[model samples]
Target: MQIQLEFPAALATVLGMRGLLIDGGGTLRETFRRIADEYPKLGLHLFDESGGLREHVLCFWNGTNTRWLPSLDVAMTEGDELVIMQAASGG
Candidate 1:
């Protein structure tokens, strides 16, 4: 399915764009894998050395935190939105 992807300003600054449309898989994992394959630089910021989401990274599926969801394997359909941002923590 085709989905819309939104990146945080910081990440977009680095990538030079804020959002795009891409063909994604049924599951989030596969979508992320396709993203990593298509944009390794952006993937570096999203995934850690172990290929897992970094501690500070947050993923939202249609405004709901993926962490709160039952699984990242949740099926996605066309027009779904995936938002990525880094958790903010500072004084």
Candidate 2:
């Protein structure tokens, strides 16, 4: 499966800028792992020691945020767009 990855900001060096077209498969976690491999610097900005999402980023599959999903176990379909955005902060 192919997923469209959109980066919201100037993130880690591996992410470069703009978007990325990546292979998608299995679970959402798997997709993240693939991205991490493609962009090594994203690992620290997104994953924890337990291998889960870090506290500062939110991911959306299609138009739905994964936080509302059954779990991060969501799978990808061909041509699905995966948007990775930096968490909004500041009060």
Writing each residue's lDDT as its tens digit, candidate 2 over 8-88 gives 666635566678778888878789888877776766677778667777778788988877888777778889987778778
* TM match of model 2 to true structure: 0.81
How far residue 46's Cα lies from its native spot in candidate 1, in Å, is 0.4
Question: Runs in model 2 with CA error above 4 Å?
Answer: none
The deviation in Å at residue 78 for candidate 2 is: 0.6
Which structure among the candidates has the greatest lDDT?
1
Worst 10 residues of 1 by lDDT: 66-75
TM-scores, all candidates, are: 0.89, 0.81
Q: lDDT of candidate 2 vs native?
A: 0.77
Prediction RMSDs, each to the true structure:
1.4, 2.0
Model 1 deviation from the true structure expressed as Cα RMSD, one decimal place? 1.4
